[model samples]
Target chain A: MRTSFKPLAAGVGGVAAALLLWQAASGARAAGGSLPSVGSVATDLGALAGSPDFWSALAQTVGIALLGLAASGLGGIVVGILVGSFEPVRYATRAALEFLKPIPPIVILPLVVLILGPTGQMSWFLVFLGCLLPIVMQTVDGVHSTDPVARDTARSYGMKPVEILVRIVLPSAMPYIGTAMRVSAPAALIITVVAGLLGGGPGLGQSLYLAQAGGDYPTLYALVIVLGILGLLFQLGTRVAERRLLHWHESYREVAH
Target chain B: MDKLMNKRPVLWLLGIGTPALLLAAWWLASAGSTDTFFPPLADIVDRFRALWLFDHFGSDVLVSLRNLVLGYAIAALAAVAVGFVTALAAPVRWAVDPLIHFLRGIPPVALVPIFISLMGFGPEMRVASIALAAFFPTFIATVDGLRAVDRGLLDVAQVYRLSRRDRVVAVLLPAASPQIFSGLQVSLQTAFVVMIASEMLGPSRGIGAMTLLAQQSFMISDMWSGILLLGVIGFAANFLFDLVRRKVLAWYIGSRRLARAS
Candidate 1:
């Protein structure tokens, strides 16, 4: 526990130094610029914390992110399981997935806005596309990496493919699936916010966009701080989940201390 | 029978069938819609040809490619240098690791407004944004890679009385190459996405800006064309990098196979 304090202190010190640098730069720009000083940004953050709109915006943002993540998680797992179980399906879908995967879903925001208009649905759609590939790819890889001996033993016991998948393959793949979720969660948030920023819907991203458009530097800074905190929380939550779920895995076991 | 079932024809159909089916379905769903919301696939293809293949969209694509390459190069160089320095010095790593991790956690998209404010609406801003986005992943990967070098190899180098620089080049770098390459691949994809996002928000040339302009004008077909171009650009970059990785890391692949076999 004492050892942990060192890391925490180092982290806080680094952030403090960065903040000092930012404040000094902003102060220098005070001669003539739209930049807000660190103090003003903190004040703005306080004002935002006191406001109902901030909470509502944050709730909306998190709601969209979670919804999108849940949908993509389900869709990706189902598709990944199908592809993993059936070689024909995997081969058939490989080209399509490869073709679609690298294309940034943000590029399709325009097409989505044209079709669905700027709505929560459009934001979800963007998030779904962005989050889907990483999860599916990881799932497929995980299933492929399932122990051959375990699979053979399960088959020898006359287990049906579905039973084998659910009981054996899934348990083995849980660690990788958790990793996939951890990876996709941040992506889901980022894409959701980006979709909102591009006028998809009302969320923290849209608030940031509006602040930028209005040239309200303090609000923009405050919103950014909010986004950062949200990201940090989600990352911390995922790290905790990973440790709990993957304690048996060698990688996690090695890092446990 | 199994061999016949796995013939080239079947493989070809398996590879190409799904996208073709999806495209056909899209065509059928939007057939004869003239509200410009859903143009026919034919019209979109025509628009793609006219705008991207035979006109100024080529230049915009080139501009984006140039920025991506320059930004990635600068980021790769800087990250490797800094990562090496930090990896060599425990105190420096402790001092800098927190800052790097925090920035890495902050989504690159969140920095666009701040970047714009600081750097103004110029190419410098765009390049800097892309460079910053690429830096953290590459730097983190490099540090990890350096640390992951085999302790036995370092011991051997020490026994051979190799200098620090010699040990890094002869033992550490070769071992770390694969992980570094993986990081670079991720950075490449991320840099492209960041470039497009920044271009869409500001400035006036790039596939992203073109898409934004087309959307604002309500040219749905043109917008699709821009998107198609971006997808192609992304695919080409990935393919190109894969080729380069294969060439550079041929020995790494061989070693991986040996490890798997054992």
Candidate 2:
């Protein structure tokens, strides 16, 4: 316990040192009028925390991310299972998936903004597109990795196709699906923020733009801090959820011992 | 799976045919489209040829590419350098761990706004934002790769009394190359996205800015052409990266293949 606490203390010290550096740099540069000190940013954060509008913006961003993730997660799993079950289907779709996967979501930002007109729906849809391909690929990998022997045995034992899929394939795919969720959750948040920032969608990102446009440097910096914390929380929450849900997985079992 | 892969012609056919088919379908389906937002593929292709291939190739595409290449190079070199120092020292790693995590957690696009504040809509801001955003993945991966080097390999190196430079070059770097490449791939993608985001957020001459401007002014075909160029560049980047990876990791991949076969 003592040894572990040492690293934590060191980490806190590092953050403090970084803050000091930021403050010093901002103070020394007379031309850095747009750059605010850490103290002022903190004060702005405190004031913003008391405001109702900040909370709504936070809620809206979270809502878009969650809604997008849920939709993509469901869609990916269903498609992944169907495709993975048939080798020919996998080959048929591989080219399309590979071509589409590497294109960054931002490339479509202009088109989506035009069609949807910078609404929450546009942000939500962008997040969905951003996350869907990775999840589908992961799920397909998980399904392909299902035990062939076990599958054959189930077939020999008179299990129906759907029954085999439900009992055997899905359980095997959960770990991959969990991994996809871990990756996509943060991505969903990032995409949502990008949409707001670039497309003028309502959320903390738009608020950030507004602050920057208005030359409220303190508020802009404060919102960035909020986003950083929110992202950290998302990461931590996903890790915890993955551990809890995948406790029976071999990786977790090995860790437990 | 092995059999399917061995049939090179069939694999090539499937690989090339699918995308070609999709494009053909899109062209046929949208031939008479009346929707302003979803213009006919034919018109978009014409604009793509005129604008991207001829007119703005140097001004927009080449400019964006130069910034991306410079930023990515700076990030990769800096991350590897700093990663070596931080990973070699235990106390430094602990001290900087949270800072790295926090900085990485902030959406890469969000960081662009901070840069805009500090640097104020210059080329420097775009490059700085891209470099910083692209830095984290490679940095983290380098540290992990260095730390996870085989203990026995180090023992062997020490037993041979190898110079520090030789040990790093021959053992540590070769071992870490695969992981570092993966991280670099992610960084490239991040850099591309941030490049677009930065240009879109600022008044710029890049493809992203042109696309947004066209959209706002209702030049639907021009906007589509910009997007089409972006998509092509994105695909080409990944493909090119894979080709380089294959060349660089040829020995590692060959050894793995031999191991699997035996």
Candidate 3:
């Protein structure tokens, strides 16, 4: 019993120790320059819970992240599958995609800002580019990995090409697409935040930047917590969704002896 | 589908052709643009050559690379060490999981402010930010990798009377390397971005700072140049790392191939 509880107890104790150390550090730094202690940060979080501005900022960032995700996910899968279906199209675009994939989408931030003028549009574009390549690559792999024997069987059965693609190929591809969504979701959020901060867009990132610039350390730290929670929720939500969707997948099953 | 392609010599055309065409198209399309915000591609290239190659590669680009290399190295080493230790101890793992998870969720870019206040807006701050950004992914990977080591393998190690150091160094690290490499790859990418972002966040002498300055000063061509240079470096760095990863994983690949054949 002691051993079993040791891990959990130790975990909690570690966290408490960390918080205490942080409080001490901040307290020491107080004379050099002002910084909030762990207690003060907790207080700020409570104060923020009751603030409308905090809620709005949360909503704004959430809205952008979700919108960007949905748009990129759908567009990417559709276009990816479409391109992946044809050998010529896949081969032709492979070079361009490969070249572009290595380059971070943030490279286009300046141009995006120039064209979109720091609106949610700016963030959307950034998020779109961030999530696009992964989705496309996964979709292409999904299509490519469709069992040739299954394709031959569908053909032998006189199934239409579309029928084979939809009935046979799409299901096989679902796992890959799910993985892609999981992989891309965090990227979409990170880029959205970066876009907001740099592009002057409407999101928690922009707000965090503002707080920092204005010397609102409490608000800055609070927003960081908020963003962290948002990221965790997004990650956890996608993981749950992936697990549910892929429950039947062999890969999702527990390891066999 | 793959076999039929052997009859044709289209690989080169398909592989490099499209990107080349796209590049040409960009140059042509932007040739006549009067927009002050977007200079012609040719002009941008010229600016890129002048600014990055001639003017600030030594000063700005080197700084970025220095920060990236040191930070990423620190992140990778620290992650593996910490992960290895935690994997050996369940209590420590449990104690630290929540904290790690919470920190992992925070966008690395968002920590720039906290780092700025704590470390100040200097090279130290930038490197610290980059290391912080890169650390979580690698650490998670290392822990996952170590944990994912086959139970039977550990049993064999024990039966063989392998010491803990031998068990980890000779058996576990190699076995879990694929996951570790994946984590390192992500760390490489994250470190570069964080390097740039931190520079942009503060008054620093790096390509990120240079780009931000150019944009603010409305040096459209210079901004484009910086963007282009960054894109190339990001691409090349990832490509090179991927090659190294492939080389390191050759043994694993061969084993998998043999398994599949059998």
Q: What lDDT does each candidate get?
A: 0.83, 0.91, 0.86
Instruction: Order candidates by lDDT, high to low.
Output: 2, 3, 1
Clashing residue pairs, backbone N/CA/C < 3 A, model 2: none
Candidate 1 lDDT tens digits, A145-252 = 899999999999999988999988987877878898998888888887888787547799889888887888999988888887788788888779888978887666
Per-residue lDDT of B62-105 in model 3, one digit per residue for the tens? 88899989999899999999988888888789889888989999
lDDT of 1 by residue, B1-262 (tens): 8786667577678778878888899888777778667788788888988887778656787778788889899998998888889998876777787777667777778788777877777878788888988887788899999999888988899899999899878888888888888888888888988888888885568878888899989888899888888888888888899999999999989888999999
Q: For candidate 2, give the lDDT.
A: 0.91
lDDT per residue as tens, model 3, A1-257: 97778777888898898888878878888535557787777888999899898788788888888788888899999998998898777888887787778777777787788778889888987898789888998899899888999989999999999999999888888899999999888888889899988778887888888888887887788889888988999899999999998898777888889
Best by DockQ: 2
Q: Decide which is better by DockQ, 1 or 3.
A: 3
Instruction: Kindly list the per-residue Cα lDDT of model 2 for residues B116-174, writing each as its tens digit.
Output: 88888888888999999999999999999999999999999999999989988899889
* All DockQ scores: 0.54, 0.72, 0.65
Looking at candidate 2 chain B, the ten consecutive residues that score lowest on lDDT are B4-13
TM-score of chain B of each: 0.91, 0.94, 0.95
TM-score computed on alpha carbons, candidate 2: 0.95
- Note the residue pairs that clash in candidate 1: none
